[model samples]
Structure formats: structure tokens, C-alpha cells
Target chain A: MVHNLWTELYIVLLLLAAVVIISQCYITYLFHKYEQAKIWKVIGILFPLGLNIYIYQIIKLEKRLNNFLQIASMERRDWRTAYLLVLAQYLLLFAVFGLFASP
Target chain B: MSKRSKARIIFFLYILVLLCFDTTYSFMIFNLFLAFAALELSFLLPLFRIRNNKEIVMSMFFVVTFILLSPNAIYVVTDLIHLTFFDFDFMEGLELKEWWNFTILVSGVFLALFYYVLMMDQVRAFLGRSKWMNLILLLMIILSSIGVYIGRFLRFHSIHIFTEPLTVVFQIVHSLDYSSVLFIGWMTILQIIICWLFLDEVGVKNGT
Candidate 1:
């Protein structure tokens, strides 16, 4: 199982590398075709920002799916249970704080 | 900017600030968020929609608790980071005066946890794809968290037998390795998930 997972990971990594190489190649081709090295430089500068944007998109999609689930099923109100969940969240914070806090 | 767009911008900027700064300003921003969340929840929850005593109680509880938890979040991270960076052992070796510095050290650590509970939904959104994307993200988070926990455990465990590095990796006996990378990375992603969840929740509650 581990072997297969590693194999998959390797393949995925290779594909990612390939995509980067291919995009760079395409961009270089376009730059030379248009004699616009300046544009290429701009693309290079913008790539990191693009990745951050991509990450932002993924987070948005995940929330949509979760909302779908919650909507379909009512998060039924049990005050006691709700209160407890609230309290549990609090306790988790408190314990974490105490563990690390200066008394 | 629309209210949400403004909030979204603030929220995203706040997250970046948290990751980058890990300071009292970040904590204050986060605490204010808890206050905002409490106010938002009061109006947006179904119980509040119905208008009852229960709603009032829940809102009050939430407001108070939110205030309490926000600081705790700050405390946890500050403490852990301070201790780790400054090399303060939690054991008997420390003088009382040194403890204050330790608080500031580990402050970044709770930021990881904050990402988990507070931001998971938003992260999922940022990383969102099909079910497969989510599954992959979940796995990544789990692995990174285990990785980070292991690192913390091992470094701390040298103080006593309980801190054994083996104990850190002992989860591997059950296929567990507590790692901060997994924890923080997963949490980083999770915060995105949470942002989306809040948006959705508010959207539904407020009507489109």
C-alpha cells in the first residue's frame, strides 16, 4: 500500500514539474514570438500571487460543499448540547492556554 | 467594497497578518473577531430568528466565551513559541522571572490550532476541488499535524522519560507520527474552509 502511494506521489510530482516546464516553455515561446521579454518577467513576478489566489479558491470551494451538507440536514437545536459544544470549545482553549500560560 | 468583500479582505489580510506577525496586534484582531462572530451568530442563528429567551442566553454565553477563548488562543501560541524559541524547559529548571518570556515564545503555536477550528472551512474553499481534492487535503493536514506534534514531543520529551522521542513516534506503532507540519499545514488549510463556512452560514441565515 505504501509503495503504491509513493509511486502515485512520484508520478504526481513529475506531472507538476512537467506542467511548470511546459508553461515556462510556452511563455518563452510567446515572449520570443512577440519580442517581449518584459512580459515574461511580469509573468514570473505574478506567478506567486497566482498560487495564493489558487489557494484562496480552493478554500472557497470546500466551504460550499460543507454548507450544502449543513443545509440538507438541520443542525438541530439542543440548547444543552449546543451549550456543551460551546463549552467544549472553550475548555479546549482553556486547557491549551493553561498548559502554555504563565499562572 | 460590499460588506462581505470588505470583511473578506479584512479576514484574508488578518490571516496573513497572523501567520506573519504572531503579535499582540494579531491577537487583538482575533479577539475582536470573536466579538464580531458572537454578534453575527446572534442575528444569524435560527434560535435568534425565532426570538426566544434561549437565543438571548446563547448569545450572551457566546459573547463571553468568545472573549475568553480568543485570549486563550493567544496565550497558547505565545507560550509554546516562547518556550520553544527561547529553550525554556517546562520542568523545574525555570526561575519565576523567566516564565514571562516563555509566554511570548510559543505564541505562534496556537495559530496552528486556530487555523484548525476557526479556519478549516475557509481553507477547504481555497483548496477546494472535487471530493478527491478534499480527501487529499484532509490527508495532508493529518500528516502535517502528526509531523509537527512529533517534532514538539521529541524536543520536549528529553526532560523526562515521558518526553521520549519514541513516545513521539509511538503512534507509528498504530501508524501515528505527531508532526507540527501536518498540524500547521492542515490548520492553515482549515482556516480557509472556515471562512467559507461562515459565509455560507451567514448567507443562508440572512437570505441569499
Candidate 2:
């Protein structure tokens, strides 16, 4: 019984995550349309993409071409790039449960 | 001196250590690891990539620990939040853990801007592959993913270490779905060869 409950919870959580991601993307898109908050446009757009890359830890970390991604021009470690991506990941995962718990 | 690489290495070490530590003690270790990850994150602060203000940092720590601890942790955070707000029922259905989670996420947007100050340029040198390194990278990815799956299974089964190794070995062989594994195995081999060619071309372009 407990196992089933936990599995159900896990599945619900994944669905919640999918909704939150899609919702956030929409809100970000709307903001982009409004011509408000220049800073958020870059972040609101790039953050999600950076995030999707980070959580994919199963994909071993080798060097991705920084210039290729347009994240940074140099081949060196893009500290800011890493943070934005990793942070987005954690936040998305964090907000997910709440999305499911509600209604 | 790329601290990023150093930080990555440290994070890798921490994960391995956490896996080896006794499960009961793992929470303490996990909180510590969360702190370490946060600290490593701080090195990026100067670049403004990761905003390091107090509220944001606390929220980050709280959320990281909250996730690391699991559901029962959900209650303790809720109770604490309730005590502080004096609203026993603030944000209905919002457990302390969930609320903390939301706060961290909401705050991240405001914090995203400080990231561009840091200059980056260390990566151009190593795109070419050693056939051996490619093989090792592939092996590590497979092993780590299996480790993750096994870790979850053991937690569910309530089984501890004496049997953990056995499960880990079983997981690697049985891990990926059969058809996908066959496809991925070949794909990975091809990737290594393509990567080698690309890196060689980049080298030639640079040498010009």
C-alpha cells in the first residue's frame, strides 16, 4: 500500500513538473510579448534551456562548445552559464511538487 | 586554475562519498554536500551568474536540504513556517517544504541577472578525444546512471549495503531497455569517432 502511494506520488510529481515547466515557459513568452523587463527576457528564455541541460547528469559532462551555444565566446569554464543552468534545474524541480499538490 | 573544474571534481567526490556513507548519517552528509555545492556556487557569484544575496542563499540552502531530506522533512518545514507566520494555515495545502520550494524558485528569476559579469574562455583546448577517454566517459555515464537506479531501488526495498554491490552489478547489465541499449551502444561508438574527427578538424583550423 505504501509502495503504491509513493509511486503514485512520484508520477503525480513528474506530471506536476511537466505542467510547471510548460506554464513557466508560457508566462515567460507572455512577458517577452509585453516589451517589459529586458533582463528577464534573456534569463526567462535561456534559464530553461540551461536548466534542461544541467539536470541531465546522466549525460556525462564533457566540454560543450561555449561559443556554439552562444552562452560564452570562450572555451573556458563559463561560471555564470553553469550557475544559471544548474540553478534553473533546482528551482524547476522545487516548484514541481507544489504545482501537483494544488487542485 | 579553473575553479569550475575543481568544483566539478569536488561535487563528484561528494556524490561518491554520500553514496558510501551510512544511510542514517547520509542526511547530515547531504546537508553538508548541499553547503559545499552552494559554496562552489559562490565562486560563480563574481560573474553574476549565480546571485549570492542572503535571502537567495538561504532559500537555496533551505530548498536543497528540503529536497535532500524527503517527505517527512515536508512536515517539519511546514510547522516551522506556521510558527513564524502565526498563521497555522498559511497557504492552504502548502506544506512548509513546498512553500520553501516555491520561494526558492520564485526568487531565482530576480537573481538571474548578476550572471554576466564573469568572463569565460578556458574550454577550447580539449575537444579531441583519446579513444580510451571516450570509452571511460561512456563507462562512467552508464555506471552512474545505473548507480542512481540501484540507489532508488535499494531505498524502496529497505535493503542496505551488504547487498548493495550485487544490486549495482545487476542494474548495469539490466539497466537500459534492451533495444535502446543496443542502439545507444552503437551510437556511442559512432559519437566517439565523430568527435575525434571534429576535434582534429578544429585543431587543424586553429593551427592554420
Candidate 3:
């Protein structure tokens, strides 16, 4: 039973990582289309394991999109999806590591 | 909210979550904080406009501090050795706690590398794109690898450079050997690959 639980948890974590990577890729596409996309942003899609979402957040907050029409057409919340996914990934990892285990 | 404020809040919340899980890892938390602080310093260092000789001197001081603290970020990668604590046989089932610990440790390692890359990116921007800037980055990675070696094997902290400068230097000189040199070279290569993949993509225009 314990082994099964571990497998399930591992699968969940893998799925979360995959979703985060996809979200990051989407964000990179958006940045490329509407803004002065950074190389780091492209690299983030290729290696979504670390720093991509954080970089996305930093860029989103620091600069406005070059094409105002694109910004107006897109929902504001669209830009935040990757950030939320990354946060969820961290929260899940920490919650399992910290709260579920007995001291 | 400002970028700095948002980053701080996220970092604070991360710490709070970790503390809530286990206070025994306070030392790890402290190290993470130090790495985060160094990353923030690097990010902020570029924004400072030097107006006079005094400002330039202060900026230089902060630059040195950033370089010294920067190694702590990469040093976190060495902490993966702790994962050996969860020794389990294939014959036996894995425990939930052990599995979670493994997950957390790997995540922490990734996060630390991420921090190192982000910090280097900021420093790269501060230095601008040039052959000399690339050389400086290579030099920084080599120094950081040596710093990791010193920290991991010598068990010396970065602060020791200021407090016990002679002993630290002496120990570093004496500790030189084939194995240590090999380790530093391997680490430097690993860091360069990471930088090449993440920070130095070819054919991509630099973002403003």
C-alpha cells in the first residue's frame, strides 16, 4: 500500500511538472508574439524545470507588451496562468514534505 | 506590487512553509535565505546608478559581496548528498515520507540552480555583452566552483574569508590535489553547460 501511494504521488508530481512546462511554453509563445521576447524566455521553455515561471513573472510585471492591441484582445488572467501553476507545484511539494510527514 | 516586493513575499512564504513543516532544518532555511539574499543583491546591483566616486566605490563593494555570496547558490547542489539518507531496497516498498523527502530535495536542488542562473543573468546584464564580460563570467564560475569545494570539503563558510582570511587561504592552498582539481573542473564544466543552455542561447536577440 505504501509503495502504491508513493507511485501515485510520483505520478501526480510528474503530471504537475508537465503542466507547468506546457504553461511555460504557452507563455513563451505569447511573449514572442506580443513583446520583445528574451532568449532566457525561450530557454525557459526548453528547460522548464527551474526559473522559467519566475522569470515570466518578473518580465510580466516589469514590462508592458509592445502590441497594445494584443494585450487588449487577450484576457489579463492569461498572463498569470504559468505563475499560478508554478506556485501550485511548490505548494504541493512543500505540503507533502512538511505537513503530511510526522516530525 | 513592485518586483522586489513580490519576490520578497514569495521567498518569505516559501520559508514559512518550510518552517511549518520542520524546524530541524533551520540551518537549511538559513542557507536558502542567504542564497536568496545574494540573488536579490545581484538583481539590485545593476539598477544602482553611480553618480560619483563614492557611489562607484560602494557599487564595487556590493559587487564583491555579490560574488562572494553567489557561490552559496551553487553550493546547494552539493546538498543532494543528503538524499542518501533515504536508503531503501527495491525489495522493500518506499515510504511516503521518504519519497516526499526525495522529491523535496530534488526540488530544492533545482531551485538553487535556478537561483544561480538568474543571479548570473543579472550580473551578465550589469556587465553587458562583450568578450571581456564572457571571460569575467567564466572566471566567476571557476571561482564559485572552488568556493563550493572549499565549503563542501573544508567546511568553511563564506564569512570565513573575512574573519579568518589567512587560514582560509592557507587551507585552500594546502587542500589542492589532483582530486580537488578534477572536482573543480567538473563543476565548472557543469555550470558552463547550464549557462550555455539557459543564459547563452545562440541566434536569439537580447531582450531589453
lDDT of each model, Cα atoms only? 0.39, 0.37, 0.65
Most accurate candidate by lDDT: 3
**If ranked by TM-score, best first, what sequence of candidates would result?**
3, 1, 2
* TM-score of chain A as modeled in candidate 3: 0.60
Q: List-wise, what DockQ does each model earn?
A: 0.04, 0.05, 0.02
RMSD of 1: 18.0
Please name the candidate that would achieve the greatest DockQ relative to the true structure.
2
**Each candidate: how many clashes?**
58, 10, 0
As a whole number from 0 to 100, the lDDT of residue A56 in candidate 1 is: 28
DockQ of candidate 2? 0.05
Residue-level lDDT tens digits of model 1 in B1-208: 2233444455455556656754443444544344334322322232322245655675555543433222222223323443443444558686654554433333334333333333333333433466686665555445434433433343221111121335434553544335544555554455446444553443422321
Instruction: After the best TM-score superposition of candidate 1, give how far the Cα of residue B27 lies from its true spot, in angstroms.
Output: 20
On TM-score, who's better, 1 or 2? 1
True contacts kept of each: 0.00, 0.07, 0.00
Instruction: For each candidate in turn, give its C-alpha RMSD to the true structure in angstroms.
Output: 18.0, 21.6, 16.2
Sorted into a CAPRI-style docking class, model 1 comes out as incorrect
- Cα lDDT, model 2, residue B117: 10
